[model samples]
Target chain A: MPSEAQAAPDILSVELARIAQDIDSSFDLLLPVPDDPRRPLVEAMRYAAIGGGKRLRPLLLVATAEMHAVDRDTALRVACAIEAIHVYSLIHDDLPCMDDDDMRHGKPTVHRKFDEATAVLAGDALHAFAFEILSDPMTGGGDPFVRAELIYTLAMASGANGMAGGQMMDMMAESSRFDLPTVTRLQQLKTGALLGAAVEMGAILGRVVPEGRTHLRGFARDVGLAFQIADDLLDAEGDEVAAGKALRKDEAAGKETFLSLLGPQRARAQAEMLVEQAISHLASCGAEADILRALARYVVERDR
Target chain B: MPSEAQAAPDILSVELARIAQDIDSSFDLLLPVPDDPRRPLVEAMRYAAIGGGKRLRPLLLVATAEMHAVDRDTALRVACAIEAIHVYSLIHDDLPCMDDDDMRHGKPTVHRKFDEATAVLAGDALHAFAFEILSDPMTGGGDPFVRAELIYTLAMASGANGMAGGQMMDMMAESSRFDLPTVTRLQQLKTGALLGAAVEMGAILGRVVPEGRTHLRGFARDVGLAFQIADDLLDAEGDEVAAGKALRKDEAAGKETFLSLLGPQRARAQAEMLVEQAISHLASCGAEADILRALARYVVERDR
Candidate 1:
């Protein structure tokens, strides 16, 4: 057998692909299109949730759960829950009243494909479904306390002080100038909160003690920042076809981003440094954390 | 003291008024205006959640909880959670892309007062906050299992199969014709589900057995349908100023409604019949169910 160090990258890619397929099939079963009149909403939800994106959030969740030996079935459900939230956010963000983007993941956005009202309801339904999945006894875990904690954590991460708050800050940034600290805080709340929750949820599912989960929290924090920096970099210079969405819009809109503030080279270096710091936090976990380490690196290196 | 029948209506109106005031104050404490740039979102959330409406949903929740002798604090929290969901739905429903209404509760809609993006984020945040409230041990109840159950029940009531599904059906009704049964099913899912959840949550909080809760479910189902028919009646003939929203839009849009399907006189009679049936379901509970009975009659009697 190959050395653990040499085998880590292959395992990371293989595992990510495996979880992506797993989530796709799970969502298919979870959200079948109804024969009723409301099938449009269901179809929009399925289209937005299934069929696209890197599935990075779910991969992170499942990877962390694997480190703690959580059951695959339980891990997959939590993974799907997190992914559903992510997809819902993307759908809402793409709405004409929000980001006004017509394309997402190289296809027409939900509103573009199914109209605005359907898009709104689809996103709303997906948001509710995420909590449904987490709170359901079968999907969450055998322990009700764990399920309650998952619901609490996910709700906080997604609510006023977190993702929605960050989006508000981003919109405010369009008209108001924000310092680097303010922008950093915005990214931390908007994207970092949910990413952190994904890791925390996996730890919760594994029944990891609070003290033992501290390192994972630190890892998630660093990786979340690194992920945002990478996104800014991609928007600044990456190909639209490769990125699967509009690029350079931040520049066009004069929005303050890490790229605009730090320039490409410095921002790239900062993300790499953050990734290394993220990996270091997981060092005490030994080889069981290899996939998480790979994921931290993947966040910065991914093109889309 | 007056006999139970004579005292019920007075007690209900008084209790409802008390709970409405209590909820308004609690929301004030729960959602204070933030000092950050995202204050607008918080402001919008507070505006939608706090100072307005009949607080009927929360009253239903609190009154039902009162019937089971649940703690006031626990009942209040659940009341707030259900109200949060109700307010969020109203905010989203009034969006320019949806009902396109300018006024709600005799004031400018969230989108009209702020902006569409802010309105959307605010509504989304409120939805998240509802689950946050229900899953938090301090708020939901002392029991984690109860909190988990609350989350699951609320999610099921709010998601694709419930409110969102009903909203989709309502939108579809504008273009496609629906029979009476179809419209009734739509109303049941859209509005009935949440209303039913309010009573069920009260039962759950009281630790009432599922077998014991069946009567309450039937009560909620009948009252829910009656409530919607009254709404249709108000839309068809009530004063727009008193209704606090546009009136007769259903007719203008040629949408099918209980009033259109059954005619005004018959629809009014049906609502009253439903209320009678609703009260009959609670007969086993005796005087403890008086407030619920009063509320059922109030549904058809209210001008707005």
Candidate 2:
């Protein structure tokens, strides 16, 4: 396993870029291109879907699937579908009437790059595309049952009660005094649900038994929360240039965050403890879990 | 079969009310009881899902599933799920920033009755609940694969390329001189996808194969379009009391429609032809298809 301090920065960057490229290329291959006049809309969907993000969710899915001995190739289609849904959510979230973010990942948001109308359509197309990919018989071996489960799990995690629900809570908390419990609940839903889903989905596909499933969920939950807290810490400490996103934007927005509720020192300590729990949960999962473990640590340790 | 003119005003109203009640009671029996804090949100979801509109989409699903020889009791869960997703979409559509409707089904919109934030969350929760119902292992034997496929199918129909895409087109056409082709495409996507999915999902659950699936697809396509054209004609010619929506609001909004693009008479004729096509495709399926046939015609021929 590559230690954080010993890993060459340039080599690490190159490898990450390659993984991203692979995910993007795989996604582009899966998008629908019907011969109908809706082709333009489909093309726009592909463009919006294939171009963005660090592919973190897909990587986590692939990694988790591999941990349970599921072939990466079998998991590839699901990984693409996961990213498609993630991208679609971001597109909708960035709409002018939604979060109204002008930029994402240093590029203009979907509604900015495309017109709002196209952005809306593009997002809708991407949403449909994710399901289409999931239901494509080729992806699920003509087993409607497996395809159906995949869709249900993804929808629950991504829809209101999961990620979107988390967002609603966050927006609600903007003006309210949120306690630590409230803040924890919000992040768990918003970020942890999807992350938890990513790993649990892998277990499902990998056919992991009850014990393994419980451990994977535990690891995902602790890591997800710790990672989010670290993100708050990064914003409080990092420069905007290093962060990509606006530094201290949480404070600017007057949002209730871990840092705001728990103070900087305690927040960092909590994150470290959570990371330890995450690693401990992964102890029996072996080397395949190393990348994910490192990634969780990096979540807090990175400047960005 | 209930003939259009022979179906009296009070009888039609009673039929619709009974359908709504059956659907509502079935859903109430299925949903999990959330904790106290979340109960109100769940109630709002049930209210928005059950208390509005004719249960046309659920009828399609249940009828089609029955035609494939599936027990109606077994199909009821899917029927409720379809209606839930449809209702969720309508709630979002009526948001102030979306279609901005103040009334639906002759009553104040969900957003107006509740508040905008509650409406949004209600819609979101309904979307999640639809999948939750489908995914519940005890329901439908917890057929994970079928559950996933149902979810994927509904998401595709409801998301960007299907309903949302169609809606974005409607918004765009408000300012443009959209031709018949554009109008038809929008209608098929916006209104057709979910309707088609409703029918197809029933077919999936019923395990309908061969010519039956193809025939149902054909039947649904035509019926779906007919339903939209009828809606267009109703907006142009029906009364607010009869239509249960803002009559002539489409014209006032300057939105392109089948009636606007093809005159009211031609639009009505087109709807009739589609209904004929729908009925013809169901010919090989036997008398069990009668309910579906009646429902298709009912969509276009009704006063409301």
Considering just chain B, what TM-score does every model have?
Answer: 0.96, 0.91
Model 1 lDDT per residue over B1-304, tens place: 6698685768767887898789999999989888999899999999898878988888888888888788888899888999999999999999988999999999999999999999999999999999989988786557888888888889999999999999999999999999999999999999999999999998888888889998899999999999999999999889989988888899999999999999999999999999999999988887878888899999999988
Residue B54 local lDDT, model 2: 84
Least accurate 10 contiguous residues by lDDT in model 1 chain B:
B1-10
Reference-based lDDT, residue A216, model 1: 94
Interface RMSD of each: 0.6, 3.8
**Candidate 2 structure quality by residue, lDDT tens digits, B1-304:** 4686566664344545666787878877765555523454556676676566788887778777767677777778888888887887788777776677888888888878876656766776676667667766655546665666676677778775688777777776777788888888988988999999999899878876545689899999999999999888878788888767677878898987888888978888999999999999988877788777778778898878
Error of 1 at A113 (Å): 0.3
* Residue A143 of model 2, lDDT score: 62
What docking class should model 1 receive?
Answer: high
> iRMS of candidate 2, one decimal?
3.8
